[model samples]
Target: EEEKEGLDKEEEAAKSGAADGSGEDGGGGKQEVLDKAKGLNWKTGNPKELKATAAALIEFCKEHNLDIPDDAKQARMNVGRLVLSMKGSSALEIVEEAIKKYGIVAAKAAKAEQREAAAEAMCGHPGNAQLLLAFQELAQLYFKEGNRNAG
Candidate 1:
């Protein structure tokens, strides 16, 4: 009876771990992006800037064969909306072009959230951070240009 109870306990533990789905096994490439985004330094920039940054970051990830988590995609879309709201149609065009080149699977809204999270995780990697930061700066430049024209 004791042996049977032990086997049951082991089975229960395995089931519990599987239910959590945290991907503790290091094979969770998607979850990695989500975790990275959650841990990002929000102080680095404004939402508009972050959106642009995330777009660029997505491009980088694609180039490197990295997978962006599903949750990250939602975040990217939210940030991208803020950027578009601030910069207007031109920015939208740029995002559209990128999506076309990459594929519909890499839509703006989804890509933004994923990149934002991925970038947060990649902060420790200078190359990744630089690329993302550059994207943000470019977006800021476009924003300023738009404002100037409006003025």
Candidate 2:
């Protein structure tokens, strides 16, 4: 009975925190950054707002201990590109991408299984580097083709 009561109390606390956005899992830490991004007066041609938005995103990543690119200049450039290429991307989405890119979050069980399967498949390859290079080239080609099709 005591254990059940304790579990109930903890569950309630978590629920309240999530409902009010007062817990880390609820993005309480990111609310200020989100507000700042949303508060910006964005225009397609407005460099000031674009720069501010990128700054806010970078700051958010830093605060969350996500890896920024090793090349600072390239990171900024990529962030600029992301800001300009926004079709329906949200600030939260941008941060989430960074988190995934940096492997900041642990993979779910299914993802882990998939990764393990891929690794096993690749283990028998005699020329891993060459295989990877070919794969990268093919991926780039596919991306180019996709862009052409989209536009």
lDDT of 1 at 52: 56
Candidate 2: tens digits of C-alpha lDDT, residues 30-145? 35544444543434357777787777766665665444665778778876777677624666566544443442322222333443344434545634645643554576577668
The lDDT, on a scale of 0 to 1, for candidate 2 is 0.51
Each prediction's TM-score against the native?
A: 0.23, 0.39
RMSD of each: 22.2, 13.6
Report the number of the highest-TM-score candidate.
2
lDDT of 1: 0.44
Worst 10 residues of 1 by lDDT: 18-27
Worst 10 residues of 2 by lDDT: 103-112
Whole-model lDDT per candidate:
0.44, 0.51
